[model samples]
Target: MGSILVVMENGTGGFVDSSKELIAKAKDIAKALGMSSVAIGFGSEAEKNLKGLSVDRVIAVSNPELTQYHPEAYEKALAQVLQKDQPFLTLVANTTMGMDLGAGLAARASLPLIAYCSQLSVEGQEVLATSSVFAGKLMAEIVVPESGAVISVMPGQWPQDTDRGDPPIDRMSLDLPSSMKILQLIEPEKGDVDITKAEILVSVGRGIDNPDNLPLAEELAEAIGGVLSCSRPVVDAGWLPKSRQVGKSGQTVKPKVYMAFGISGAPEHQQGMKDADLIIAVNTDENASMMDIAHYGSTVDMLDLMPALTERLRGE
Candidate 1:
């Protein structure tokens, strides 16, 4: 039986969404490969938050140097742990920190590394990874040509298993790299709607046609108390900021409510928001591909319906 180590970054707020998604996928890999799964993370107080997972073991390395991310220090301490554990495979989330540390870890450990992988599977004494190429236009399959493999998984690519039983804890203290220390932390200015946290999102698409029509979609989002997102085309045309774009080339969202306005539902656009719990597409074209998966839709053009709905909401 093989042993795989799952390295998670438990930061200030808590364990990131991507970490949980990785653990879920790790559990599947562990089961399929007949391997034991051990979860490791670093934080000032990270143990309590991760005690509820179904992992075989949870290791918390507590230190102030790890309070904020310092890539070299993380690599050193994590390398020590990995060398000691000698796990057959290691997995981590493909985030900013992951990107920073992935190459260094692979070099230090002399293992094959794969980053931003969309999926993972075990073959005969080999692990296969899938990733996108050509700006998401093509998918490439990667195989790790080593006995020990390091993989960094993309966010929202794996489904999280919230039903896993409580995970056991194994607390430990590791030597901190003296060179690492947190200096200052700066937070970004949050928007009116934190699109990342929004459970319900109503995204505007290419069909809106003009920037002047954005307010109408904003009104609809306001009515539903949801975040307003856009497809790549809208952002490319400067109708919306790049931060608001939702697609394969943009942000990946899994909101509870996904309302597509005039979106033609291209494969690229659908790739971003396919995980939405409930999808409602409103477009004049009744036969657009977006309508195929839409739970509720109207054949009327959004231009004609939006003003009337806004006025009705305002009691006009």
Candidate 2:
């Protein structure tokens, strides 16, 4: 059996959380298949990050063209690496860069592609990938071709690999094409806090009614010493920045306590917060989807509940 390959992505500090999840899953798959797990990362910081991950081999391609995300440059560099080291299965994160890179590589390399995977397993001679389709209402299991396959797994579905290791790095210097250059790396302005790292969150939704009523939720968050967060509708209405939004398109959070106010709980929104240790939902509609999955739910108007909760917490 060939090695299990985990294609990693570089982020602000090091490898992104999604990539870490893949590393853990890859290690498990490698153990099952009696094969070694190998990881490939780009840039010097990625090399530094890859060195600490618990994998059998770490392939680091440190080059200027590979530092930032360039579609052509990355594809070219990765293609060369793939040709040199043909792994049986390659795992990619279901993120923006990963999606593009995985699809492009599958097409260019003529490899079978399995995307939006929530679970992956090796059974006998076949590899199976389970994906959620129809906006996550249905599950589709696909059989990966045994020759070779590329898979993209959804983020937040698996536990992140945190074990540290000092793996030897195999450095590669590819003669990558210079067809494109990233002139300015414009990033979203950093928010007051990283919601993904917060332990407690007071999240508001469209049920808050007006933007002026946001103060109630903010006060409640302040009183509880939690960060103020919101659903997609709240961000779309300009009541909160996208930074504070929690949903499929936004950051996925696994806080110790997640308080949802007036959220109708669309499937997209639920995907982001379903993993919270404790979910407390308050909505006017008792049948709201959010209420069904919440640990504790109340059908009281959030407009009435926020201030009362805030005062009670402050008094205590």
lDDT of 1 by residue, 6-120 (tens): 8777655877777888888888878887888888877776676667778888777776567577777778877887788878778887776776788789889988787668788
Residue 93, model 2: lDDT of 89
Task: Using lDDT, give the best candidate's number.
Answer: 2
lDDT of 1: 0.77
lDDT (Cα, 0-100) at 2 in candidate 2: 76
The candidate 1 region of ten consecutive residues with least summed lDDT is: 185-194
User: Total backbone clashes of model 2?
Assistant: 0
lDDT of 2: 0.84
- Clash tally, candidates in order: 0, 0
What are the Cα lDDT values of the candidates?
Answer: 0.77, 0.84
Q: What is the TM-score of each candidate against the true structure?
A: 0.66, 0.76
